[model samples]
Target: MKFPRRRRDPVEVNLTPLIDVVFLLLIFFMVSTTFETRQALELELPESAAGTALEASPVTLVVTERGRYRLGERELGAAELGEALSAEADQARLHGLVVEADARAVHADVVRALDQAGALGVRQVRIATRETQATSTQAETP
Candidate 1:
């Protein structure tokens, strides 16, 4: 008995699902990307009506309510604060300095940090503050 041979059809890849997956990934990435960038710090920053986010990452100096200083994650003594800031200022690509002070922090402590930054010749210094809520019933005419 002789057996009959059957011709095979050409193999084809369907790209509709692949194209759908690529578009879904593109949409996910676009939705997940953050446009406004700022370093996170654990502090109850004072509220203001005119606080804006910083575009460039600046050297962050956090001043606690108890007059302690933290610079980019390093805790320093009052004397060491100046030294650390000076070293940061010496860096070739130092963008700027940001002072994040607790709302209840002593005024002098924040001023002292500012004084140190100024003494180190840091030109661009920004004080961080949270945005004030607009629910205030009392309006001040300016």
Candidate 2:
């Protein structure tokens, strides 16, 4: 009797399951992640009775008690504020402006900065303020 040789089978890899798992992970990250726009500088804003938070990031203009105006951290005079804002607008896609005025600063100064921002084509403008803290650090001092 003659013995016959057995044929060998070829090996193969299935990638359907691996591709499905990768797509599931991508969808999970896209749905669960939140993105925030942070300002370059930290600021201590004054309190206000009618202050609201914005959903989008805005260019910040800080007005000190000494009547100095600043765009982010750079100080600008009234005459140059518009030019500075325009220069910044060239680099930004969405334009919004927020004026953070000190409690002791004059209202006219804040208005002037808003006007300058508007002149630079910033359609959305807002004023910045801090929420009142409930901690009793001499609440009756004022």
Candidate 3:
């Protein structure tokens, strides 16, 4: 009598563990990444009765008491401010300017800076202001 022939089993690759590891790596990278630090130019902003905080970061332009202007930390004149802002706009994809003027700076000077930003195709202009302080005398009286 002839012996029964044996059959060979087919080979297969298991991908479940591979796919799980790939997903874990994706999550690890997402959680491990850090955001870039934003640069700001500090100034003593003028007080206002209706000052509000902005929801997003803006490109800052500081005006000092001596009629000096600066973008970030670089000092610029009226003519140079436009060029500097334009360069920043190109780099940061900014469409507006946030003017931080000192309380002692003239109002017309601030307006002129805003006008220059407008001429450079910056459609939106925001003036930075500090919230008005409530005096103790006023609070006690009322």
User: Could you give candidate 3's per-residue lDDT for residues 1-28 as a string of tens digits?
Assistant: 9988889788889999999999999999
Model 2 regions lying over 4 Å from their true place: 1-44, 55-58, 90-95, 135-142
**Deviation in Å, model 3, residue 81 alpha carbon:** 1.5
**TM-score-based ranking:** 1, 3, 2
Could you tell me every candidate's TM-score relative to the true structure? 0.63, 0.55, 0.60
Winner on lDDT between 1 and 3 is 1
Tell me the whole-model lDDT of each prediction, alpha carbons only.
0.83, 0.72, 0.75
Ten residues in sequence with the least summed lDDT for candidate 2 = 35-44
Candidate 2 positional error at 35, Å:
22
Tens-digit lDDT string for candidate 2 (59-81): 67788766777775578777877
Give per-residue CA lDDT, model 1, range 55-87, as digits (tens).
645588889888989886688878899888887
TM-score of 3: 0.60
Q: Scored by Cα lDDT, where does model 2 land?
A: 0.72
